[model samples]
Structures are given as structure tokens and as C-alpha cells.
Target chain A: MLTAILIMTGIAIVLGAALGYASIRFKVAGDPLVEKIDAILPQTQCGQCGYPGCKPYAQAISNGEADINQCPPGGEEGIRKLADLLGREVKPLSEEHGTEKPKSVARIDEQVCIGCTLCIQACPVDAIVGAAKQMHTVVAPLCTGCELCVAPCPVDCISMAPLAETVETWKWKYPVHELRSAA
Target chain B: MISRLFNFRGGVKPESHKTESSGTPIDQAPLPKRLVIPLRQSIRSTARCLVEPGQKVLKGEHIGQGEGSLGTGVHASTSGTVVEIAPYPMAHASGLETLSVVIAPDGEDRWIDRVPFDYRKVSREEALGWLRSCGIHGMGGAGFPTHVKLGSGTGIDTLVINGAECEPWITCDDRLMRERAAGVLSGAMILRELIGARRVLVGIEDNKPDAIERMRAAASTIGDDVAVVAVPTLYPAGGEKQLIRVLTGIEIPQGKFGTDFGVQCFNVGTAHAVHRAIHFGEPLLSRIVTLTGNVAHPGNHEVLLGTQVAELLALAGPKADTDRYIMGGPMMGIELQSLGVPVTATTNCIIAASPTLFPPPPPEQPCIRCGECARACPADLQPFELYWFSRAKNFGKAQEYHLFDCIECGCCAYVCPSHIPLVDYFRFSKGEIWARERERTASDQARARFEFRNFRQEREKAEKAAKLAAKAAETRAKLPEAAATAAGTAAAAVAAEPAASPEDLKKALVAAALARAKQQKAAVTPKNTDSLSAETQAEIAAIDARREKRNTQDADKTP
Candidate 1:
């Protein structure tokens, strides 16, 4: 009985020391889990889910502060990816976020526009450029077309325009795969 | 056993008939009278066309320049006249139209006062920038901007000059390194200095002893800054990622770059160009092209940009009645539709061939479980599964199987018992996934923007209603006092004022909606809630107190 007690005590002390050492030695500075989650998120700062950017949404998801379904811009697929990352059930996009639509950008018709720069200030990505009284123009490449600009246009000059596709910008999506035996 | 920790798989291996043309030093092909130089040479947005149609241009004159940091300028391939500017057939199998500037050579390859280099007099950054203006890109296939490659500001510990020339039947780099080892070595020194590396590793395959000796002597003269390390002659040793692995035993993780490993690999040919750019002030306007196979005179040629394949193939001796043409090496080079495919910076080997040079691939058959393909897969992916999945267009499941990981090296198909074109499937799968991702991202962005806009609109509508109601209440309160006898008459007029002006009513509504939106925005934060007017809070508290008091009074009455 005495020998068994001594062996058990020795084993416990060694295990405890090992665990303590490992806790300090392998400690990562930043949360790798959060970094990985952030990497997968689309960086569009359209705040449709009420969060400012994908990183904030990732943080909110990590902290259990926000639902992953709030971002309509992520759409059903994005929500699914977030769900998988968070190990939560995928939920349908909340109707409060509005329905999914094709990507478009706000543009002011130069001829019709009265040199109002309200849209410029309202643009989150700073995709618009014009003086307060100058004819506004959209930097097509920079425009995410969040339509944040459209609401602020006093003259109601800004309208949404569909993005044009070209041969270079077009990339084919990945095809499907069937799970098979590794022979 | 080799540790399969590196999860690369599902590569296709085509018949590598490399030895056919890689036997001797590059020979010269007669320069064509005219060279059609395109403004956009590298993988960047096309340069703006500067010379109008019919404008005379000199050999060293600037044709056009790239827009952003990743772009390189286009120079005259030869003293030429700008003939046309429009989308022309590109050097791709798709025969895709890309914006090109056609230049007709005047044949007088006159020199523009070229800048000669004095190493002691110039700074390294200036040399690199001058090379960019001269338009040097990686000549070993992926024509990434050479300046961009050198400009990676990482504190490189090692400079890897890839002299392996592993791609079969492509000896342009080999020929350049062998004939001009001094120049190639000089370029390596420039790269070493640019990267600030303590050690320079010139990785050459053991196959070329002649080239190895030349480079070894050059490195010795340059002190111990650069060392010539000959690796075992293996196929694809020249592949940038694979070469880094073979030398350093370090895997560059996905989405991470080679510079991340403190090692940047450059083709020996590219290093030669860097030497010319730094030393001679010469832009990469020309390159050594291997012209062999199905030709009467089988030799390598130094080619200028915009030289039609037809012209080179003609110089190489016309293809026989049964001849087919390929660009680059036989293994990875593209098969040309006609000899008309304009030679870009990417073109190194143009394989004009008959059945003897490139036998047609046999009809694909079902896998008999021989597993020869698995052994050949450089990427180690189960291509059999990918093939089935891609055929079904099941991209999600294909991605789950790590379709994005395949480098499309084309090894599995070479050793397959049934020669399946695995690269095509991988490419198709990758393309599909990219398209779907782009589609999803676009739609998601649209939806979010739409919701936010509607929220603004809804708030505007509600505000207008509130403002009008407040205005009506104000008018009604003052009407009776202001007009005692004409109280009812004035009341009607006041009501008309609120009803008559639709524009004013809309503006007032929008203001009210803006206030509501501000309130909604504030609800999400503690600061916003705390900063709310005390009166509003008191009113809410009072309403709650009144409801409680009324409920108690009602309860007492009920008893």
C-alpha cells in the first residue's frame, strides 16, 4: 500500500509539471483561431450584418455577441461558411437585412448632377470623388457600390448601376468533386 | 519512406521530349524585316497606346508604359512604324483578343544612345528602376514583372538563382547561362545585393556540366557571396516552389510567398537580363528562343517581341504537311493554332513538329487500378476523384477535396495507366470555384447595400409623417387665438398650407426619418443610450410609472 501510494504521487507530480510547462511553452500570442476565421471572411466592409467589417463580425462571432446571419452581403453561403467556422448551425439570412441582389454601384449622372457632394461623404470606401459643389465621379475599380452614397444625394442624382464584366476580370468558378477511394 | 507531409497531388505528366532540341548551343535565326510589338507585354493592364497609327518609332523608343506598380513599360522591339491599335488574337489556345499595338519594322535596327553602367557611380535602387522602364519580365514562362520580383523588400537570407532549366526541350535559359555565364553571374550579384543576402545559392542540375563549370568560375571571382550548388538532375527542378523545397527543405505554405521564407528564386536567364539592364542600360526587348523540330535548320534563335511564329517557323524551315506547332517546351508549352501566334515575352521554345516529335495522345481509357498515376502525382491529390467531381460540376465537394491546392504540374497524366488529362479537370474545377466565389461576394455586397438604403428610405418616410403631424398640431394650436372671428376660416387655410406643399412635406418627412435612423443607430451602443436626452428617458420612466400606478388602481377597484 505504501509503495502504491509513493508511485501514484510521483506520477501525479510528473504529469502536473509536464502540463504546467506545456501551458507556458506552447502559448501562442494571438488567437490563431480568430486569425484563421478572419482570413476566410470576404473583406467587404458593407456592414450589412450591422458589424463594420468581416473582422468585427468574426470577433462578434467569437465573443457570442452577434448572430452570424445578420450579414446579407455574405448571403446564405457566407453565413454557411461562418457557421462552419464557428461550429454553429447555419441560419437563413434575417429578412431585416433585405434580400440578396446582384452587385451594383452608385453613380451620379454627370450631366443631370447639380455638383452635390453628399454622395461622396456618404461613401464608406471613399469610392466617390467631387468637391461639395463639383460634379461627382465614381472610381469604378474602387467602388464596392454599397449604395451608402445614394441615400445622401440631395438632388436624387445618384443611382445604382450594374458592374460591367470583361474578359480579364471574369474567372471561372471551381467545379465539383466526388469523394473516391484512394487506390 | 519519404514523408508525405507536403500535400501536393494530382499533377499530370505529359510526354517530356526534352532531349530532342536541348542538345547544343543556341543558333541564330535571321531577323525578320518587321517586328509587331504589343504595348502590354507582362501580366498587367495593357499600356496606353502612345504612338498613333503610321507614326515612326525607333528601336529603343517607349511604345507605352504600365499604369500601376505591378506594370512594366513596352519598348520598340526594333526601329519600327506603329501600324495599328486594336484587340488582336493573343498567344493563347482560346485565341482570346487582347489590346495589341502592331509595329512594322523598318529593318534598320539603329541604336538609341544606350546607357552604359558604371557600378561605382550608381545606386542599386536606381538600377532596378531603370530595368523596369526597360521592360524586363521573368522570361522563364510566368512573365511576372522582373522589377517587382527584385523589389520584394524582405531581408533575404539567400538568393537562389535557378539554373536547373528543368522544363524539357527548353534550353533558352540553359543556352543563355552557358554562353554568357559572366553576364548571368553579374546579374546574380545584382540580385544578391538587391536582396541583401549573405549567401547566394545558384542551383543547377548535374545534367549540364559545361554550364556548371562556367558559372562556378564566375562565382569564384565574385568571392564567396554566391555558391554553385548542383542538385540531382530531376524533372521540374526549375519549378520555383519545388526548387525552394529541394534546396532548403522548407515548404512555402499556401497564400504565403517565397520571400516569406527569406529566399527569392530567379531564373538564370532572368538574372542575365538583369545584368544587361544594370550593366548595358538595355531593356528586355529581346530574348533567346529555341527554334527546332520539323525544321531543316534545327537551332536556337534570339527573338525580338512581336515576331510572328509564322516568321520564325518560316525561318526554322516551314512545317511539313503533317506538322503541328507548340509554344515553349513540349511538356508545358501551349500548342499553337497556327504559326500566327505572336511571340510574347513568355515564348521560349516553339516546337514545330510532325508525328515523330509529338505523337498524339492516345484516347483516354478508364483507370485499371494500376496506381502509376498516383506515383507520378507531384501534388499527391486523388485525380481520379477530382475527374469525376469536375465532370459533375460539384465544385463545393471538389474544393473540400483541396482542388485549390493543385499546381497543375501535369505529372499524373504522364504515368497514368489510362492517360487522363488531369490538369484540365483541375483547371476547370479551380475556375468554377473562383467564379462562384466572385458571384457570391458580389451578391452579398449588393444585398447589404440594398438593406442599408431601404433603411434610409424607411426612416425618411417616417420622419416626414412625424414632421407634418407636428406642424399640423402647431398650426391648429395657434389658429383659434390668431383669428378669433375667422378662426374656422383660418384653420382651413392653415390645414391647406400643410397639405398644399408636397415637396416641403417630403423634406420634413426625410428629416424626421433621419432622426429616427440616428436613434436606431444609437440603440446599438452604450454611449448612444447614455447620451439620450434626460427628458426622453424621464418620459419613458413616467409612462412606465403611470402604467404601474393605473394597474394598481384598477386592481383595487376590481376587489
Candidate 2:
């Protein structure tokens, strides 16, 4: 028993020392799982997710504190991807947050400007450009339609506008049999 | 020249309607008053308009610049003044609009200064660069830039010129070979020289003996490198992969090109255009289009690019009952959305639709899982499996079945007893897959942007917190000893000391609880009794007497 105990003690000490060295030598700085989950999200920076931003929501998801269905901007497809990545059962989207809509960009009516810098502060992506008391304009491509800026604006000049489909961006819709019969 | 030609796995024999279009000699189309030239003609095209409205352009003058290395250039088909530069309907299967340059042709049809490149004096790369600027592309429906195709021509062995115009009613290639045999052979020689190939094999379908004879005569005049051979007249024997397989007996691997196997293919019309571009300094401005079906004169015409289909149909004399038009052969053609859409490099045939000649497809029936479609697939793919997966939207399974390997040849559709539009399903699935991939890329980019924004916000917050902490530390360090002692004493007064023992803590807690109970009882005492009526006072006195008696009885019982 003494010999066995001594051998086990020696093995434990060696393994513990190796593990300690490895922990310091090859330390992972950030949570890669959170990073992967964040990568899967639509980077709308639209806090329809209860969290402050996509990264925080991703961190919460990695920590098993947030449900994958809370993000309306990510939509069903995003939820499906997250479920596939995290090995969880797919669930319906939680209706309390919002519903998934077609992609849009936040457009500001520059003419109705009472440019309180409140909107500038609330924007996560910094897509809106303006001075403290001047008119503001939205860079359409960069704006994520977060709607976070809309609540902060006193004049309520900001609104989400659906993107126009050009020939380049047009997608082929599935043909319906009933529709074909009319043709 | 005839060799032991090998056969591919599956192909159907469609009726060759060549005599309908090939009866007469090829004719030159009358220059229209206006030409609406679409800037984009090739796949993944990025043609940028170079001229503004009202700018005078000569015939063969470059009117659009190629935006990317793979983009094809566009030139004026006839000397004309630019009338409009705006979005117009283009001849595409999707019936979409593209940015086009509208030119009103001048009656003179003036030519620009011509400068031909000497192939023997310059490097093959330089010759190809000249060809790139000439706006030449494959006229075999694909419209691929010929320069890019010949870019990888180094160390190639065999160059196969596809002269097999095997589609049912399309005889553009047949007429091009019969009319311009010498020009086609010259372009083939240039191709063979550029690719440094040992031999050039021209595969024309045997049904067109006139084209075969003319091409053979032209080849004999030119040296021994060019051999004009006749392939068996089969539906889609003119297909790039099919013709390659028939001539060389090599099945090009999936997701690979003909050049991957030391072979390359070009259309005879493309060769003729190359000859004109290199020898005559002309760009691909016109193409021989077959105008047949519900037309009085069913023949081939060398129609200028950007000529409206309506104008071309008028020249061919369309029947009064012609309801629609197809841009290519009936087997793989798309119906024209409007007759006003202009033709492009890929428009080889335009069939005016009538009730008798072109009837609507029968209503689709349920797939019986018969293996006939599989046997008829030219690419040797299982059509029923693709059909089921696509219909079910199981794209992953469809992809696993090599759905993209399908050439969209319509062979399976032609042979299907169910009359199902298999090619349409394939096209729809491909478009969906492409759109999904684009969305995935966009999502990834958005994620990066969001992550970066979050990171910046976090860093800013951390910096703010650190600055506040530093400010507080600075203020504390600036205070003298006496002030620090005074601050410490004030802080100590507010901070209560801990209990010394468990008994002391219990006694303190019990005293606090008794005091709280007594305070609560005192607060519940009745108020404002001075305004009571006389009867109320008497009732209160009686209740009080009863309470006192009850209290004495309870006390006695407890004792």
C-alpha cells in the first residue's frame, strides 16, 4: 500500500506540474466558443437581442445563460446554424423580443433634424454621420436598421427602410405551380 | 477526316430541323436605324459604358470598357451617334434589364482605322491581349471571353473546333462554316499556334455535308495542322464536354475544364470572329442568327449586335399568329419577354412562336421513379434523385448528388414521360444556392463589423473606468496627513464594529425584536374618539367590560 501510494503521489505531482506549466504557456486569451457564435450571428448590432451587442449575446450563449432564439434579427436560419454549432435542439423564436423581417437599413429624414447628439451616442455601428446641432444622414449600406437610434431621437426622424432590390442583388424566387398555370 | 469516334453515356436523338433554316444562303441583315447595345454580354460581366450621349462612334470603335480582367469589351456594330445611355431590357433568360448604350446609326456605316496584329512577330500573349480588346467571345451560347479561354493554352495538345451545330433548328454555325470557311480555318490556325498544339480537330455534324465539304476544302488550303472531321449528328453532340468526349474519348472530371485534360474547345463562329479581330481589326459586333418557325423566310442572317429581335423578325417576315419568340433552340431556349429586347453575342437563333409549331408543355405528372431519365442524362446523373431532393428543398442532399454537374442540356426533360420541367428546377436550385452563399458571406462580414464595434466600445468603457479610478487616486494622494486622518475618523463613525461573541449577537437581536413588536402594537392603537355619539360610547363601554371579564377568565384558566 505504501509503494502504491508513493507511486500515485509521484504521478499526481508530475501531472499537476505539467498541467500548471501548460496553463501558463498556452493560455487561451478569449473564449473561442463565443467568437464562433458571434461569427454565426448577423452582425446587425441591432440589440433586438436583449444584450448590448452581438458579442455580449454570443458570450452569454457560450455561457449557456441566453437562449439562441432571442435574436429576431438573426432569424430562423441563424438559430438553425447556432443550434447546429452548439449541438442543441432547435427551438421556435421567442416572440417577446421581435419577429424576423426582410433586411432593411435605417434611413434618417435629414430635413426634420433637431440633431440632439442622443442618436449619435446610441448608434452601435456608428453608421450615422452628424454634428452636435446639425443634420444627420445615414450611410445606407453600413446602417444595420438597429432601431436603437430611433428611440433616443427626440424628433423621431429615423426610420427603417427596406432595401431596394437591384438586378445584381435580385434573388430568384421559387416558382409556384398555381402561378405557372396563369401564365 | 473520319476517326473511330467514341460515344458518351446517355444522349437522345432530337429531330434535326436544319433544312428549314439551311435551305438558302446566309444573308446580311439591314442595319437598323437604332441599336440598343447592352454593356454586359458574358457571364460575370462588368462592361462599363465609355461614351456619353451624343458622342459620335465609328463602326468597330470601342464604346464600353471591360471592368475586370475577365470582362468582355463592347464595340459599335455600325457608325452611329450615342443617343442614350441608360438601363434597357436585355436578351437574357431571366428577362432582366441591364445598362445599355443606345446608338442611332448613321447611313454612311463608316469604319474606324484598322490595325491588325502580326501573330508571328509578336508573342502569343500580346496577340491574345489584342483579341481581348477586340471584344471577341464564344458565340456558342456561353459567351465566354476568348482571350481568357486561350490564356491557359500553353502546353495544350489538341484544339477541338466545335462545328457541330446539333441543336434542332439552330443553323448559325452551319451557315457560318459554309459561308466563311477560310476565315474559320485561319482562326483555328491562330488558335493552334497560340496554344502550341500539334493538331487542330474540327468536329462538324455529318448532317451538314455542305459545311463539312467547305470546311475540308478550307483546311486543305491551309496546311496539315487543321483537320476537319464530321461527328455523328446527335443532340448536344455540340456540347463542350460531349464533343470533347466524342472526339477524345475522355470524360472531363466534374468541376474541371476541357484544358485540364490537355484539350480545349472553341466554336466555329468564335474562330471566324477571332480571324476578323486579328486579321481585319474587327470586334465581335455581328452574329449569324437563325430566324425560323412561324416566319416566311426561315434562314440565317448575320445580324448586328444590339439589333432588336422585333426588327430581325420583321426582316424574316413573322406570321400574323406568331405569339412569342425563343432566343435559342426550342430544346434549351428561353422565351423572349419582349420583342424589343436587343440581341447579344450569345443569340444564335430566334424562333418565332406559333400555336402549331410550338405548343405549351403538358401539365406535369407525378414522377413514377422510372430510370429512363437516368439513362437519358448526358452527364450520367440520376435525375429522379435530384428532382426529389430539389422538390423537398433538401439542397444539401441535392448537392451531394452532384446537382451542379448537370449541364442543363434538357435531355432528361426531353425523354421524361412525366413532362416535368427538370431544367427549370435545376436552375431554381442553383440560383437559391448561389443566393444563400452570398448571404452567408454577408453575414460573416456583418459579424466581423459587430465584433469590432463591440471591441471598441469595451475598450472605451475600460479606458473611462481607468481614468476615473486614476483621478480618485490622484485626489487621495494629494491630501496631507492631517486631512487624511480627519477623513478616516469620519469614515470610522459610519462603519459599525462587529459583535465580539455569538451570545452578544443573540441578545442584541432579541432586544431589537422585542422593541420592534412593542412599537408595532403602540402604532395600532385607535385614534379620534372625542366625536363619538352617546349610543356609540355606551356600546364601547359594554364591549370594554366584556373584554375585561374575558381577560380575568382567561387568566384564571391559565393558572
Native contacts conserved, per model: 0.18, 0.41
lDDT of 2 by residue, B176-293 (tens): 8988999999998888888878889999989999999999998888777678888888888989999999998989988998888889899998999999988988888899999998
What's the residue-level lDDT of B207 in candidate 1?
73
DockQ of 2: 0.27
Candidate 1's C-alpha runs over 4 A off are A1-183, B1-33, B42-45, B117-128, B253-255, B459-559
TM-score of each prediction: 0.66, 0.80
lDDT of 2 at B247: 90
Q: Which ten-residue region of model 2 chain B has the weakest summed lDDT?
A: B478-487
TM-score of 1: 0.66
Which stretches of candidate 2 lie above 4 Å from their native place?
A1-40, A61-64, A79-93, A107-159, A176-183, B1-3, B123-125, B459-559
DockQ of each: 0.13, 0.27
- Among all windows of ten consecutive residues in candidate 2 chain A, which has the lowest summed lDDT? A174-183
**Candidate 2 CAPRI level:** acceptable
